[model samples]
Structure formats: C-alpha cells, structure tokens
Target: MAKDNDPRLLRGAAVRQRILDEAAQYIASQSSIGKLVSISIGEVAEVAVYVRNQARVAHQLKLPFDQEFWGSDVTQEECKARLQEMNDDPSILGVILQRPVPDHINLRSLQSAIHPLKDVEGMNPASIGNIIYNDVALAPCTAAAAVELIRETGLNMEGLEVVMVGHSEIVGKPVAMMLMAEGATVTVCHHMTRSVAMHSRRADVVVVAVGKAHLLGPDMIKPGAVVIDIGINQTPDGILGDVDTEAVKEVAGWITPVPGGVGPVTVAILMRNATIAHQRQIASGWLT
Candidate 1:
C-alpha cells in the first residue's frame, strides 16, 4: 500500500460527486409531488456521517440539496414507527438502518417494512434479486464498494481463483455471487472451514470479512496475491482487520489498509445508491 494519498482516490471521489450532482438534477426536475421525505439516521454514527457527507457532496457538485434526517431510537415500537414513517413518505428517497441493533429490536420487521424502492442499501429482497440476476439495480452498498475496490486493482478477475473468508448474507455470500458472475472461480469459507489457509494461500485474490482480528498471517498468503480485509475490529490499540496487514503487505503486491481502504469507499458507494434511489423515486412520480 502506498503511504501517500493515491491519485486514483481523487479521481473516484470526482466521479462519484458528479453522479450525485446529476442525480439531484434529475430528482429536482420531477414534479413537485415527488418531494423527498424522512431520512432515518440510525444509531450507527458512521452511517449518519456518510449520509451527511453525501448531502454535502451533492451540494459541492452544484445540485439542489434538501433532506430531513430523522434518528430513531432502539426499541421495537420505535423501529416499527420509523418504518411506518419511511413507508408513508413518498419523498424519502432512501433509508439507512444502522447495523447491530439490540437484541430486543427485530431486524426482519424493519426490513420488511421498508419499501423496495427506498431500500437504497439493497438489503431488500428485490435488490438481492437484482444482484443475483446481474440487473442494473441498487445493491448492498458495502458489497458493491468491495467489488469496485477489486476492479480498481486492475487485476483480471475472469477465471481467477477468489476466496471469500466470510459467509454472512451481507458481504461474503453476495460478494462471492458477484465474483462468480464476473466469471471468476469463487470459494467461501467461514469458522467451519477446515484449514482456511489452504484455501487462502491458493487464491489469486483473498477477501477476509470475518470479524476476527488479524487471523490470517503472512505465511497463510501466497506471494504477489491481492488481499482485501473487510473486518473492522476495535481493540485497545485501535481498529484491526482480518488479514495481518503488516505481514501480508510485504508478501502481497496489493493490499487495502483497514481504515482508509474499504471503509471510505463503502460510504461513497452508499451515496451512489441513494442517488439512484432518488432518481427512481422521481421517475415513478407516485408521491407527487
């Protein structure tokens, strides 16, 4: 990884800013009935920051910006109420749900309550189907961002062996499907996988998403392989990822850093999804 800022990051930021600007224009031109409504700011401050940044990014791109952010408390009734508000508002272009809600809160209830069009995060079934079928639709932001980061590597994924070290529906499974869709051979391993290093060492590309910190060491990776670490583990020292970054960096030709790597891009991709959702809402003209 380059210690200095990458010029490519600037280019990506410019491209995404343009998309947000153009998307706002499209939304503004729609009839008045399509005014955007309720944007829920979940407990995840990271997500809230992303949403606010997207709004700011849109303004910087010279687009009309007007959005109301609503934060919902963590409670069964509160979640249901928030969903109701989201569903009731035709102008709400997108909704973001902070992850890891308390045990008392029901995720399924909130997920089901969200209208498919406003499910910008693409956790919704429709979005999943779009991903499965390779349709041009909004997808889970983090997964999409990870795939984009992979593409930026300039590695040819076609026929390459890729190993995804997580099995969650959120990232691992979906990313595996995306890789397979691109004609790459994909393997998914989790806690149950026997000898994960055997799978990882052989892969041309390795994506580690399990929450474990620095589980994969330099010896577990092949020389010149690409490594993508998706886990964000907070320890006393700070944050860590699944791949042993320091050790792997010497062996792997390209590796993404924990904080500045996938995390920032993941938020940027979510902005992309919100823009798409806004455009779709304007096109439907249902709320107007």
Candidate 2:
C-alpha cells in the first residue's frame, strides 16, 4: 500500500476531472428540446444524471450520485426508437443505452438502432467490430477504464499473464480483447469457472467482475500483481465488489476499491465518450 498522494492517483484524478469538466460544458450548452427523445425515460434519466454529475465533478473535483435505475419497465425498442429519433436530429450529439435490459427484448436490434457516432455505450455490433478490428470507434467505458488503470500503474503489459473473471460483453470480454491486443496473454472465467482462485493466483493481473461478494480473498491474488475489481454487488454491507478489499490490499501491490475505484473511472470514461461524441458532431457540421 502507498500514500494517498501517489502520483499515479493524482494523474488519474486529474484526467477524470478534466474529462468531467469538458463533458459538463457540453451537457449544459446542449441540453434542449431537440436533444430530448422518448426512450426508457427513466433509464435515460438515470444515465443522463450520471453523465451530468461526472461533468459537475470535473468542475468541483467531487460530486456524489445516489440514483438507481432498478425496476424500470423500459423496453429495448423504446430505447432504440428514442436514440434513432434523437440521432436523426442534427442538434443531438450523443446517446447512451443503459444496460442489463430485461430478457423480453432483442438486445441486438436495440444496439444496432443506435447511430455509430452516437453509440456512447459502445455495445453495438459495429462498435464491437471496431474493437475487434482495432478501428478506433467507441470502446466500452469500463473496458477503457480498466486499461487506463493498468497503464497508470506504469507496468508493462507485454506478455504479462492476465486473467479476467467474468464473461459479460460490456466489461469482461471486451477487456480480455483489449489485454490481448496489448500483448498480454488473456484468459476469461465466469460463474462456471472451476478453480478460479488457482487461475487468479498464477496471473500477473487479476480482474474480478463476477458480481459476487468477496469471491476473491487475499490468498487468491499473486504478489506484486495489479488487481482491478469490476464487480458492483449490493449486499448487506451496501455495495461490494467481488474481491475482498481488506484481504487483497495487504497481499497485492495495487488494487482498486469498489465504490471509489472502478465505478468512478467508468463514469469518467463515459463522460469522455460523450465529449468526443459532441466534438465529432460539431466537426461534422451536425451541431451548426
């Protein structure tokens, strides 16, 4: 464990603030009737609030978000229609579809309905294709954040053994692809993985996102390895990640805590995507 004022922490905090500030300016100047559409209004509100707060934090250096999007009866088609309608409007710059959609709707169609330029969530096939082909299109926010966390540690990822625990398209799979692209040997394990701790102990980097509480203890991690806990489980303790922070902190060289860790970086990166979307729209003469 290092001091709170570690230079890497400061650098990441600075980058997070800078993006939030730019995003806030874009959100304020651009929030108007033309940009409003009718998708899962509640989900849109939830995600928009997140974007705005991150933007606000960029200016104030700290802001708290306490909204939840649970139990919303928002359909994928409704979300798609809203995004399509907004994208049709030249004034609208970007859009994000909050995930964990119910099983009743086709996620593929909903994701495809989003314009590539406005697909800030980056889950659409085109966005996935961009990541697959290394085309530089929108990458998943959490995936980008996970990579950024590792990069800020000043460790070389080349040929490092990387094990990701979780198989979701949004976080785990994309991150595995990214690590592989960065020259690290990557392995993905999910809820069905047998002996997952064995894998974590052998890897140079262990990323846990299984949404379980305290699945990885201190003994599971390898010494001097970087651990990024991507899980967000709401337990009796409120919010908890898959990794046992107290146990792992003592054994691992680097680790990210749940609430103040990956969550903040995820929101910050989303704001970056929004800012880039806004700038792209402006450059393409869509916002004029």
lDDT of each structure?
Answer: 0.71, 0.70
The digit string of per-residue lDDT tens for model 2 on 87-162 reads 7876554555554456776767887888877776677778877777755447888888888788767789899899
Give the clash count for each candidate.
Answer: 5, 0
- Deviation of model 2 at 193, angstroms: 2.4
Segments in model 2 whose C-alpha atoms lie over 4 Å from true places = 1-15, 21-79, 100-104, 279-288
Q: How close is candidate 1 to the true structure, as a TM-score?
A: 0.80
Give the least accurate 10-residue stretch of model 1, judged by summed lDDT. Answer: 6-15
Q: Estimate each model's TM-score.
A: 0.80, 0.78
**What tens digits encode model 1's per-residue C-alpha lDDT throughout 141-173?**
677767777777788989989999999988998
Looking at model 2, residue 83 earns an lDDT score of 59
Candidate 2 is scored at a TM of 0.78
